[model samples]
Target chain A: MTRDSSSTLPAPPALFDTAVVAGVGLIGGSVALGLRQRLLARRVIGLDASPEVLREALALGVVDEIQTAPGEWLRAADLVVLAAPMRALAPLARDLAPFLNPHALVTDVGSVKGGIAAEMERLGVRSFVAGHPMAGSERGGVTHARAALLENAVWVLTPTDHTPLTALSRARTLVESLGGAPVVMPPDAHDALVATISHLPYLASLAMTHMVARDERLSLLAAGGFRDLTRVASGDPRMSRDMVVENKGALREALARFRRQLERLEADLDEPDELLAAALEGKRTRDSLPIVKRSLLPQRHDLVVAVPDRPNQLGAVTQTLGAHGVNIKDIEVLAIREDGGAVRLGLESPEDVQRAAGILAAEGFEVRGRS
Target chain B: MTRDSSSTLPAPPALFDTAVVAGVGLIGGSVALGLRQRLLARRVIGLDASPEVLREALALGVVDEIQTAPGEWLRAADLVVLAAPMRALAPLARDLAPFLNPHALVTDVGSVKGGIAAEMERLGVRSFVAGHPMAGSERGGVTHARAALLENAVWVLTPTDHTPLTALSRARTLVESLGGAPVVMPPDAHDALVATISHLPYLASLAMTHMVARDERLSLLAAGGFRDLTRVASGDPRMSRDMVVENKGALREALARFRRQLERLEADLDEPDELLAAALEGKRTRDSLPIVKRSLLPQRHDLVVAVPDRPNQLGAVTQTLGAHGVNIKDIEVLAIREDGGAVRLGLESPEDVQRAAGILAAEGFEVRGRS
Candidate 1:
């Protein structure tokens, strides 16, 4: 509820004297745009191995200065964000250690965090915060970068025990000014969570793409469903490869669990009862997702209620939830039967579901399912 | 080129004396609506084991007559469509044989064709056409059904070698009247193709959902890409399970191929060059799909062009294609560079891609990739 848009950000021109954004791609360029648009930096410096991209970033006004080899820029930078591929963050830490002012805050926008934090610890990048802005598009490059790219997105920061509170607050402040909802987590927890949500899907898409890529007949017959299922498969190969490679441990675990679940479904294919139950489970799980809300995170309970067939049944249920201060995100008549139909209510947050369910059940309503 | 929208369809009342749709689900109800909307059916009858669905379908005006059982209505039927799940198709055939007139046409709308075709054959149903309307949504039910559901969609008919020409023509005419593009193929081929393109992705989604559904943290952080990738996974569990079960052989094969491709990419994660190439290949294949146009099926070739950096470069390319009568469905600058960048063009069909590419290349444009 506290999340605000970037348009409301006050000019914070002295937040950082000179900030460097390495590898000026979409995410990197967005960071630069946010810094400039919010006036958080006096000068935003761009650094990329691709000279053409660096020049384009400069021409697009993504940065006030371009760092060709990172000597003077790194020495002058009050903050350095390694907005490069996941694989490059640790190695770049050592490369920038010599030039970086010992007091300057160093962080990154890598998908994986724990290993990167550990690697940075080994590389002696002491003043560092592991960060990831969960805002991106299938498109890449500085041309697509927008100042509001991070608006309403989750910006996760993973600070180790060695990190100071000042750095965390600084990162949180920047995230907020750029219209991001900042969430703090342990580095490993962040890695594990992203692995399941992001990396696992990337690989799933990749596998499915490769599967159907060879089937010309199937590709011709492919419909919207298949297209949607594999849309992320068209991601930049290098970046995708880097994510899996860097987060191998977490991704491997997720993939293994995915494979096991698939095998279980495959086995249950012959058992109609089990298959139907699993299929319903899939529906319940999917419906439970807080897709209707614009939360930086998913927070909802899919509460299935069996309401008696009466004139004011649905109205009574809504009034009850309203009185309990629980907001219903979505409500659907999932099934209709003789005695009462099953109404699935999506409530904002698990706490809301419990409170609303308690109120409804106490009022002689049948609470069937919550996922 | 001959494709037309349903709005242009003539209202030819009394095209068919009697038409019955078994199982009043989305597809079944849509068929009845299309038939009635196009004025192709004078009297449309509905039948479903579930009396509630039958009653709803009637109330929705999807059918004029309701058939309690396959008794009297089928004997007078000019056309009969088994619109139930795949598992129910064979039994319905047997149940209808006694009532069906010898000359009456029988068809079905099952996702998997071969197994159902075989089952019908075993049941001695000779006047059958296996069909699949390549039109569907994540949501199902008669309430969601529309007369225009099949408009501009592919209605594939899989007629075995034993099928009569009259039955095939009848099915094609009905599909066309419903504003669908009719394509004919053998039943087994249809099954294999759908297994790879549709069933494989369904399983992949199921595996992913089951995998991450247990991970509350990942579900919280699930983003748009993940949602789209898993959208198909929330399908009617019974329908999804039936698809995989009926076409288990082909699905298993596709799954194996997918697993192999994944393993290959997994092995080459350390090799950046190989992984990047594979990723690019994935993009190329995905881009090749006709995502822009609403074709009966995916038919366009994705053409990649390297155009010189100029203000009128894009306009010139579009003008050239316009002059050649090659309609571009979608065009995007895939990558940007200093003097020129890579542009991907989605042409309506492969012929258009070849013609458009020829014109562009002859004018000194570099055609980089075509798939």
Candidate 2:
């Protein structure tokens, strides 16, 4: 919980020392704002292709200065962050290579690492370290930037065998300064892992969204369930398109594996009696997941008690616990009516159960243990 | 906004009036609760396999009485609702065939309808209507029941040509009483639509969750994007298994289309130029959706004006807007530093933009158009 400030790392030259943020939109603008808030930089400079966006960024104060030329800006910046589209990594690296400061540590905020690393190699930006701040919202652009967006989020750094230890340490320190947890890994491993977790999911959401879109009636009938499932598909298409295309091999592998799961479930559906036993087994297996994996913690604890079957009985029980300074961590009304019912109460500690039971019994209610 | 009291129908005779709820769990329990709360039922009787569940249901006042014996319950009730597992629909119908009240209308809350409809026909329940209330949370079980869970949700009803007009009208009334909007369609069409909109999304979520589960380290690194995308995968395993199994055909088609999309994107990824162009196109398409779809209104009409980079700029802008009695819907600092920055002001209407801009200009702050 405590900040590590003993690294003896030199303070950023100025509170806002000419931060050159390439592709100044959501992530970049937020980084610029965060640096200013923490006094990490004295001035935030921005680079972008769209003049409208540049004007928007400048008007929004996302950057103190806007540079039309990347090379010129890179030469002047102490720290350069590439926050552009994933596919532009190669050209962007090439543009920065010739003008990069000798002491400057260039990094990126791209989702995929292997591709960025390959691009950097092609661009001859040997000093660059690949970094991705695992933070974002569905909404994009500088207008959506928030200073504390990166706080407590994991910032992953993927470095090659040839990457310098000093540069790696610098990147880690920068991530930590922003209140982010830094995780280090190799480029290929990062790409493969992200393919499974990030890239494939985006494609899956898109596929599902597109499927619904095909049936106009179904699309209109879509409720929160549909909305929640397809929310990711509504993200920046360019980002999604790049992610799916860049990590195709890994994504294809993941999709194939996923299809197998569906096929297995489909087989069970065709024969219910035979599958019924297996289905029950599957249910038990699902139920025993926490037991099988000792590392996993139960979402809530278990407790048993009795309450009236009257309206708002669950509410009343919770209210009573709240009043007595006893928190009913989680409650499961086993049964209810105007007469009586059993309810399971999840508590933070076993000791609280005794007090809670007593409190309810005093209110003319019956109480019992779960078993 | 007002309830139409004149349209309220009188209750049927007690002997001929009974609410039948199959598989009395969360959704079923909530339906029973709603029936009682709105006085839509003369008597509420529940059918469940587990005696403990039946006891709990009665004790909680979720039902007027419990019928542990399925045959007896199905025969006595005037309205029968199927809320059991999707896999159980066929067998349950078969079991209730000989006992069903001659004039009783059967309906269900199964996520998929085509599979259930086939089972219903086999069981000789020609009057059955399949339905899905597109409202539910990650949580399940009777304990989580809420009377208002169906409010404002879309309740879809699928009926065949043989469906009686009286039965359909009755079902509509029940759905409307629960504060739900009813959408009717054919069984096959319902299944196909849900495959795209509902079942497909769940499978997508499950696949995403599974993908993350494969990589322990990457799973730990998952942030909001990963969490949001996979939220539906955390639903009850039994229910999910049944849904996937029952809706296999349509889900398979959905998965196939999704795979094709991934393949195309993968091909494009090999060519960086094409990939970048695609990404840009996606970005443009997503960005323009709010404008293109005039019906999908933006959350805020208030403009966010980027203030020039300067200290106290936000304070000065807020004070000026406050003086004009133009309440600030929301305020965001797009970027800030020692030199200057922009502040976005959310107004109540587009008309308020002019007044706010004039006020900020007079206060010596550079104001811009709404984002």
Candidate 3:
């Protein structure tokens, strides 16, 4: 019934007098915008090797102040986000080390955490919390950055053994202030987990794409499933290469595990039960994963309704839900037919899903989905 | 400026007096609807073992007549489309052979083709044209059936050496009339291609999902890329199992090819250039895949515009396109930022893309994308 684009997360108490976001690319620019929009810091500064990027950030109001490079200006900051490319993170942190105030809690938005945390420690940035916001776009750079990119994103904060409690708390507080879910874990654990969930998946997609490339005609036959399976392969090659290389140990282990699974599947081709079990297991696990909505806030519960493919069917379904006082967080036309169609409605809560399903079913709509 | 959802392809002349579609499931129902809507046949007779399905098809107006099973009614059909389960195709063809008119051209909509083609050959259905329509939905059954499902779809027709030229020509004509792009290939070739592009990718997704399911926390950390990579894993297990099992030989070869690619990636992890080269290759191939639009009609050309994240930015872009006499075929909000956002506009032709890009750039908008 309502389309609220505004933030619903509670305003946070101002945590910093100043925050410096280095690099001013997608991640850094987004961090600056989030700090400014959420009022997490009084003054936000942008630092980048490129003056043009800094000027763009300043003109866009992503940062209140701009710096061509890290300098004494960092002393005024309570927070510093190192969001340069993977290769540049250590050097940027090392350059800012002497200028940073003792109380300043530094963090980063790197895909790999253990290497960066160790690098930061070597650079004497003691107040460092390695962070990875599990959010991105195929498009990169500040021009494609937005404060909303962090909204309800699972921001993993990997704290090393030597990391100060105050630094970790401050980093978590900043992540929370930006409307990101702060998930705290050890650096090695974060790297290992991401290797399975993120890095290995990217490699698999790339490998699959490569396999398809062997036969020029294979791409012509690839349907929507193949496109979706290999979507991540189109991401920046240098960046993907850096992540995979940095986490190669964990990635190799994950690849071996995946290979074993394929072997099992290939061996059990004759026995439909094993294949069916694996598919069912996959479906169950994938269904259980939280559906990331536009805002990525309070999870949305979805239900599919089989409606007659006539005029105003969608209007009627929405109206029926509206009458029941159920707000549809998201809706999509999954398939269209002249005689019948399937529409998926995303509700805010499980209770709302139950209520809407019961009401719709009574109204002669066949509804089914994971609530 | 114009939004025409109507078929642009030439209207098909009535090629069949009566077309019989066996098993009114999603594929069968869609085929029947396509035949009727496209005026490819004067009448469509639906046949299924279940009277309930037959009744539903008749009630839905997807067929002119309904039959519980193949019998004397099949003698009137000039075209027969076996759109049943993969396992049921051969037996259904065998059962229908006794009643089918000698002039009737037979075809199927199975994912795998070689085995089915050979089985049809053994059944004395020498007129069979094995087909695999690369169009499907995660949702199945007649409820989600649509005539548009075949529109612009790559419908592969694998005609065996013994297949009659009349049958092959009729099959291709029917496919074209349904707004499908018919691709003719050998049965073994079709199976091999789909195994690499469809079946193997499905297994890879399934394997990745299984690997991720090993860690309960991994899913929590998964972002959009992971979800998309594993999306096909949630498809119908029974159907997916049948597909993989039926095409086991080609699938096993595809699996081995994929493993070799992954092994190469693992070996080259330490070599950034090699890894980067693979990623670049994958990116190039993935990017080259055609964008599938809602209508799935004539191919649409795309361009990305970096618009300022201000109110009415999208409205202004559309208005600009409209003023320039360019119609947007498909539009998507790729990313949003307070200062900038990436909007991808799909135009009807490459010329339209060039003109629109130049016009937008002249109007102070930054546009970049594949043409």
Candidate 4:
């Protein structure tokens, strides 16, 4: 130690000695895995009503220990995450409150925050922070859970007047450790924000779809743009109903705002310049969206390869690149024609594009750089 | 000398001995290419005001001959396609009517049908048949044209009082020969149908984008669902404005219907059952859409494969299948996690699924048949 100055540095302890997760589903299981993988907790415990789910979590190594219900073991927990269904959250929070350690930082992963936040505040749980992780899948279960589910996800944290400042800080730190960006807001504010961002858009999509469906000719003529506009209309009805109904008040306000916006657009039809300006503004905003920017990964260049529109043509192109050790960072079918279609392959570097283009050309595929 | 039965049978003549496609852009160039490739015409001619475009069209073999303007050679045409812009269609029809063969079937490929249909009727063009091929791309020009662009597309033929029955029948036959499904309707009816299907949905998407863009917090929180609902808003503003303004009357009616639908939905928020029913109806209709049905290619089975979230994983998987001669009909990223993600691969048959599963499994990939 005396010979090397760097060796004198002290090793930091784990962020938490023990962490507990309720509801061993996608969100819950993912948090358990994240805690372990990030070395943020010395031991992770899973608490689920289903013993079978607990066993699966243990087998998957998502948790070091399992509990069928709340007990004295919870007193050893320094952190607790409630990942149960919205309806189950209240009862579960009440049951665990007595056993939670005084210093435990409690949090949740629920989609809606207003009702749950009020319930948690009434329950008087230990240093609770209501959170919503803006990430999900059509599929669910512990089997589908992944540690990286939280990575780069916007984890909204709604801390009430009841929550201690230190608890909020701790929750933010944990979210950051799990590779999530923590956005703090009041519960009501969170509901209103999501109403505008998610709920209203869903309603608009559903309305457009149903309107077209009413007439056979309109439905028959619907093309790719219409398809894209209504894609979210096909999500699970029950889930959508629950989310929207829970935040109906804020959603109603958002809907009124949307209607006014639509009326203004209808009027702008007479003023071509105004209409074009609005459309241009929308295009600019859409292009600059975080999702699109993220998908356009840095250092990537696109090569559009023309392949005969036959079975396995896309596979053949990807196979050719893989064989040549050229990585396709992203791939998309740009245009589909029965005789041939264009496939845009995103490569990491210009060198990859050159190599891929040459290899594809030699394989009798026409290739061009994306314009 | 005795001849084979097949050779003795009379050969059918081409659909048109000479076909002229004006305004060599995506639709025009594609039509010219289709005419040549399908042998529907013995000689395909390209006409454009731009000599550069005419030369490019000729060089690309999209057309057998090129002309910078309407000439006396138009008299030799059996068919004339007015693929010019909305404002130029009337002038082009009038200019070509003087030199057209008496029997030449003059058709057009304009998205907005009513205005052009009225113009053609007034101009008294020979055998006018206003057509709109419900197929297009964001990218245009002779270079991007493909014969198969019209394959399996629904080409709406808006025949008017001035359109002769023989011309309509001939147009339908030609469309069929080019691998398009012929849909017959009046031009105004076509405008009304597209107003509901295309124009209204676009306005809704643009309105939603503008609403969200007004709030920075909402923009920050906008996710995949919002992105899907507003995708059409990012299209070329000039084109969108032109289409919507040209069909403003019909679009206004469609927008009014949409507003009523939205109001009904807003009222249904309190009645969860009603909300759920509406959502379910939307889902049912969306699932039954032609686009989704077409994408669910026949005899194809999906297999979900676990892949570490890294560059070229998709390529590697597709390459693996291609190397083994197992064709992938479709592939999509089902879920993305930072550490890993799940990809859904559609194989041609159950046998291909079995083979792909085994091959991917042997390569250390965790594979499972889609539930």
What TM-score would chain A of each candidate receive against the reference chain A?
Answer: 0.73, 0.67, 0.75, 0.73
Write one digit per residue (lDDT tens) for candidate 2, span B1-371. 12222432222222126888878888899888776654456788888898898888888888888876576656668888877777677777777778888688788888888877777776777777788887776677787877767765678898878777878877876676565668899987777777766666666565455445555565565555556665555666667767767777887776677667656556665776775564554433333333211123333444444444434546766776787898888775543444444444667876788788777655544454432
Pitting candidate 1 against candidate 3, the one with the higher DockQ is: 3
Q: DockQ, per-model, please?
A: 0.35, 0.14, 0.44, 0.38
Question: What lDDT does each candidate get?
Answer: 0.76, 0.67, 0.81, 0.81
What are the fnat scores of the candidates, in the order listed? 0.60, 0.31, 0.80, 0.77
Model 1 lDDT, residue B150, Cα: 79
**How do the residues A1-371 of candidate 3 rate in per-residue lDDT, one tens digit apiece?**
33222423222224577889988999889999988865557789898889999889988989999888777777888888999999887778789898988888899999999888998788788999999998888789999889878877888899988999988877876786576778899988988898888888888888888877888887777757788888888888899888889888888888888889889988889888887888899889887776662334565466767666556768888998898899998786544544556666878887888999998776766676451
How high is the DockQ of candidate 2?
A: 0.14
Stretches of candidate 4 above 4 Å error?
A: A1-12, A292-371, B1-12, B292-371
Give the candidate number with the greatest DockQ. Answer: 3
lDDT of 2 by residue, A59-101 (tens): 8867788887766557767788999888786677777778888
User: Per-residue lDDT of B1-371 in model 4, one digit per residue for the tens?
Assistant: 12122322122245688999999998999999888875568799999999999989999999999888787999999899999876577788888877888889889998889988887677767488899988887787788988767766788999987788999988987776565778899988999888988888888878878877888667777867787777778777888888899889899999989999999999999888999999999988877776731232233366767776556777888888888899888786554545666676877887888899998877766676632
| Candidate 4, B-chain TM | 0.75
lDDT tens readout by residue for model 3, B88-187: 8778878888998888888889999988898877878788899988888878988889987877788999998899998898788677656577899999
lDDT, model 1, position A17? 77
User: Candidate 2: global Cα-lDDT?
Assistant: 0.67
Ranking by lDDT: 3, 4, 1, 2
